[model samples]
Target: MSRTAWRWSRRPSAPSSPRSRPFRSKPGTWRRCSGANAVMSCRSPAGRRRHRPPEEATMQPEPITCRLIVEAVAEFYGLSIVDLLSHRRPQRVTRARQVAMWAAKRLTTRSLTDIGRFVGGRDHATVSHAVRVVDELRERDADFRQQTDDVVLAVEATARTLARFHANGPEDVDPVAVARRILATPRGVPIVSIPEITALASAVSAQELTDSSKMMTGPMKRFRSEPRDRESEFDLYRAVAEVLEADRALKQAQWTHGERGAQARLDRGLKALRETFERETEHVD
Candidate 1:
């Protein structure tokens, strides 16, 4: 043991500094902290204390205006206010008026009595009855149901645009021009008799015939008979016409072909046979 040279060796100690204190929040208190610079409280519930963003409040309902409701109804029914208020009870007009009454009651906050007064001073009971009638008709009739829905949506849109326009100022747009545009649009051709089709085309100011098409092709025959047998001849002609017209349009289009020419000759032969049937029917009649 060389005691004279022995000495104790010690490890160097870390430098001492003040420790940062942990945040302590009071019970039920929300911390006012922000972003990455935030310090969370140990007492807060959860994985991390995050302040939630404020939620948006619900929108308030707008006040319903009388003009909006009336205009909406008029535009939807494709009728003027004067006509709607008239006492006419035609099927289409009455149906449209009833629909207007129904829409006014539904879309506006006005009382039933108020709605009735606005709609040509009708009684509240009458308005109620009209609404009920339309409701029942919509359930029973497919066409009526579609018409009602289309009118309702159109009126609602018109009402909204009107509200905005009035709130701002009067609009410069011409309503008549808008109406003419709507009228100019073509609609689907409904399946109807040839006579009815001609009438409709005339009413719409459309051409009744074009160079590409001919009068509908149908069987035609002439038979000599006594004056009393005229009804039988007419009936025979009608029956033949029905058969020919009932054939597909494509088949009728091909009627000029050779095969159809032969069929036409055969059809003529059948008409000769019809002579006997006509004679028998004439005697029976």
Candidate 2:
């Protein structure tokens, strides 16, 4: 037979229809035809439909509140909450207060009026003025700009701490036990310390932080049963959370720099916690 005739004989079968053609897939995988059309349907080795698993849920950072911004600023500036809320016109106090207002406006979703109320009960115009002043200072004053950045960092860190607490906090959190644990935490043996950490610790204290935490955590049951004023409750919660945040900052400082730095941080933090407690008490009353 001729080579052409031999080749022709080798092609014995016609092409199959699309629906009847063999389906190709990678090794260890196969496609099943569900109907007459032979549409490819993916399946696992167990013969179950393969499905893409759902994306894991992510925990979002909580919104930074105006009060938290103010608290953080006051803590950074070494001023009390009263100093920010007062009508005092000292350059130190005024500058701290304005920066706080600016931070509140930048970090929170509050209106200018609301920001003013959170800071010191001023009107929207005051908040606008503060924001403008801060902008101008940040442009012209390197030192002031650095200070603002530090305050912003502090506020954000504090907010993240609170967010984590809210997201993964224990449902059966015991205020008294937590407070006792906080109180029992040792200052650790004195050692090398960072000045900044020392300053923060000196400004705030473990006692104040524990007290604030207790106050906030203690009333959870009451909150569900009683018809308390929402505004007061909110203020109290913020105040308590700020204190707790301050404590955490001190602990981190301690971990990094040992006892001395932690003490300084605790001192600074205690001062701020005290101011918050006093302010929240006034609001509640």
Candidate 3:
């Protein structure tokens, strides 16, 4: 045997002192093992503990109401007003309740506490759980996520419509301009028909490019069309589009060229476009 084996044979079978005891792990708690590599190992794999999620934080309420979120969700899901307010556990109602909780958190400035209370008196923890569940479902279910997004959009659109009507006045407002303005805002909802508004905006450029030859003025093309102001609906809308495009382009050119001689041309174009727009609107009115 080698010197090391002889020394091991001569040593005591076990240490007598308390200081020489081997380490052990305890239940429900972590304890590091009693060995280390030559490298610097501050924490062993055994010593690392499982992490717990952080607690929910409180928040102040926002201007948007909890009722608005709840009603919108309930309506989209075809559930009764009492469905969210009551303790019923029909799968559909439960889904709606959870979605409403999630949306209330998103749309309203309401705290988790208030969100829970409004959505069937759930507590903050429950509300948090529901929010997580809905998020997971949205990840797994594309259709469910789409429906939820659509409902949220319509509710926001309704809110915008009300706010716009109140702020911009009820009469003589250009619906297309208001729609474009709203669409320009970040996270803004479309108060009116988004498609129609977009179509009108696109037609502005298209009509400007079109020539007088495409006017559809021939009897075959104008058949049965009750024309007003000697121009059909298509002619009138196209004229309006041309005018709007001219005005928009002039402003762009002015911004690009500033007070250079190019601005004189833009100013003249704007004057003509405004006159044309006014004439067309007057004919329609």
Provide the TM-score for each candidate, comma-separated.
0.36, 0.40, 0.36
* Model 2: per-residue Cα lDDT at residue 218: 59
What global local distance difference test value does model 3 have? Answer: 0.58
| Per-residue alpha-carbon lDDT of candidate 3 for residues 174-270, written as tens digits (9 for 90 to 100) | 3345656777985866565544453343333323323222332333244334345555445545554554454445445542654344435434554
Question: lDDT score, residue 166, model 2?
Answer: 75
Best by lDDT: 2
| Poorly placed runs, candidate 2 (over 4 Å) | 1-57, 167-285
Of the candidates shown, which would achieve the greatest TM-score relative to the real structure? Answer: 2
User: CA lDDT, every prediction?
Assistant: 0.52, 0.62, 0.58
- Residue-pair clash count for candidate 1: 0
List candidate 3 stretches off by more than 4 Å.
Answer: 1-62, 167-285
Cα lDDT of model 2 by residue, 117-170, tens digit: 555557899989989999999999999899999999988877667676675311
